[model samples]
Target: MATAAGFEGTLAALPEAKRELARLMLAARQPVPAHPAPRSGAGPVPPTALQARLWRRERTHPAVATGSHALRLTGPLDTRRLRDALTGVLRRHEALRTRLTGSTAGRPLLEVDEEPVLRFTEADLSGFTPQAAAARTALQITESASTVLDLESGRTSAFRLLRTAPDEHVLILASHLAVFDGWSSGVFLADLAAGYREGTGHLPPPELQFPDYAAWQHRWLDGPDGSAELACRRAVFASDPRARRAAGGFERGHLPVRLARGPVARGLELGAAEGATPFMTLLAALGVVLARREGRTAVVIGTPAAGRFAGALEGAVGQFTTVVPIRLDLTGGPTFRELLHRTRAAVADALGHQRLPVDVLFSDGTPPPYDVLFALHNYPAVPLDLPGIEVGQLPGPPARHLELYSPDPAAALACVGLVERDGEIGGTAEYNRHAAAPEDVRGLLTGIEEVLDRAHTAPASPLTPRH
Candidate 1:
């Protein structure tokens, strides 16, 4: 087992300034203790803190937290085999069979069904004209994507197979965000394909299911390490301003932005030169932009982290994404390089203590300190490769939801999701229109781009905030 000396030795390689910064920031926190081992049982377990939060939000907005994907498969397809594969996948992951039970002391609990029931639906539009069939298929996809799941009834996911032609088909997979996360989609697709190509019996059972993780998480939270982590997080956010300045209704607006390969490559090179990753570079730029807009030295932004730190969690299909708040203090005017370093340290500290759930961290029923969310998705890209069929993802409707995991539009003033694909960085900025005007959001994006360009071209130059 690794000791604190080992951790210190690893930190010794970093620059003196960064090492000192990390040491100071993490000095008060205690080392994480071993969590209780997960045991298999059929009893009701307390939902994870994040899941409980989503469950509360679901009371007002039905299906607002649903995540869906549409895929167009063209070629010889086996409908019966696909249905059986779906059933097999459902049986393999307990999250698909989970339901919300009665509240225990104002917190919702989860119960997993012993037998998995596949909620599969099929529609045939092969008799209609080609164009008409396509339109009908699209409509069905949209409906399935928006349909609300009866969480109390243990119906959390819905699947539909639309046969547009004798050789073409559309598959829709939708599930509640409480049980399913972005990472789970890839796992589901990979398992489905495997079950389709081979037999379900050939697939080995997962070492631990989602419920096991949930139960273990609860036990861990009530332990010594969990309490220390929660206290450490509270201290970090204690200095944050409590004023809810941004006033916004629940309506959302979206603006798409793209940077060509040239700039993205240059930005990556700049980050590499500074011993920073792409996310650190972007986060530093975003901090400068927010500081300029808000006219404050302190900046707080929320970013999601994949919570699957344990190797046992890598294959589990469940909600393992946790949002962490990265707070930066730009007290003195610093160059982009300096800001990047600060961001690197802050991100390291935040991620080091990321196991503390957001709901428990901010359980006062008041809004969180940050109003902006910055996400750089680097999820594993698992292709939907079947035996002989051509699989391609079909674009769905524009997402107006501001929050990434929940349907609550007022969760953030502006949410920026960036993805680097095909040598370019492109993403959408979903903002609450009632709080920020479209032009303002557009200008914010423009400022981020300019900051990145400056950092790439001249990283040593000071980050001058526009008044």
Candidate 2:
């Protein structure tokens, strides 16, 4: 436990290069130019059938479109076979070749082509090292979408083919969060596998294409008579002064620092079947840690929720996520277990309040003084497969950076991003470099882990100190 405490200090003391990385990521978060005549309202705009038919319209930020082709034949890989398969995969996902342009209204727009922007390459894998090939492959999977500044969007997805010492071949598919949601990963993998099999002639038919989902989305978002839910959401939004804030206006700049990535130092998980949903468990854990660190009875953390909770927008998959600020107050009234109950209630209330765009929520003469932001991604359960190969699903990692500042005028602030994948829950803490030592950051995560483990069994005991 004492050693775990030291781990926190180590994180706080990450090298300057790590800090620069954090800064770059932070800069990436600045607001982009607003779209001209952007959809008005807290709710997302509905796309028309014509809009849905366009590949660019369906592609969204936080999800990248990438392509990869691999050959694992009985003999030497047929470059011809690999190239053909790659072309087919690229064609299937039109977004791969799509580009974005700013509308006259300043809104972001998408453009698609039957051909791709970057041409495909077939490297000599038999001679090249795997790591070298992986890195090379990462570079070739170019961006179909970019920010207004022309900086590559901070998202990534990939198609990789590996020859396991001859005779055997494997394809690995992955995408970063910027262009794809966790839910969509499964959909993509499964389809890629099906598509690959069909391309290779092993499968009888390709399952439903993405167009099916787009068609469904257009029908649902557009009112039965042909109008879109956009007008309704817009009406509600226009009436609410808070709805007009900039979409990505949370913070101006970041200081990127890579803490030493060691074994989780400490972590735990809540089973999916426990009837205790992840949201509730996560909130409870967050509340306990923040309360202990700040020595305050209550702490507020911002959570991102899909604002498109209405069934009407189920098929609409743009950037519909909203930020919800949850306050956990543990003043003298309740014990850990009791406070957890309060935490659950607070989370529920905040979800309902999520209708307000963060721009509005923070727009008052004053910004809400919350120091931490935690988002839960319980992506729906789905199957995943890549062409000729089966892809295994693992709980995806959460955002590594936590931008922390004291929400209180009197206190300094620290941020921690807590995420759970598969059943394991762990967090990365971000503290003000000026106010926090590398050791202190490590201590925070260590303390949280101890609190969680001990709390699960001994919920009544005071949290044990690690460092």
Q: In order, what lDDT does every prediction score? A: 0.77, 0.42
Tens digits of per-residue lDDT for model 1 on 157-264?
989899888999999988887788878888889999999999688567577777777777776677687888888888888888753544555676778877556655
lDDT of 2 by residue, 1-467 (tens): 55745644654476654543343343234332211112111112222222222224125422212222222333344445555554555555532333344444554433334453324323345566777754543343322112111113312334445454354444444432222343444434444454444563432222322222322333333324223333433343342212112233332222222222222222123312233455665566666776776666666776767655545333322323455667776767454466656776787777765334453334334444464555555655555333343333222222222211122211223455445654455445545454455676566555545555655666565432211
Top candidate on lDDT is 1
Look at candidate 2 and tell me the lDDT of residue 252. Answer: 22
Clashes of 1: 0
Worst 10 residues of 2 by lDDT: 34-43
Top-TM-score candidate index: 1
Model 2 TM-score relative to the real fold: 0.53
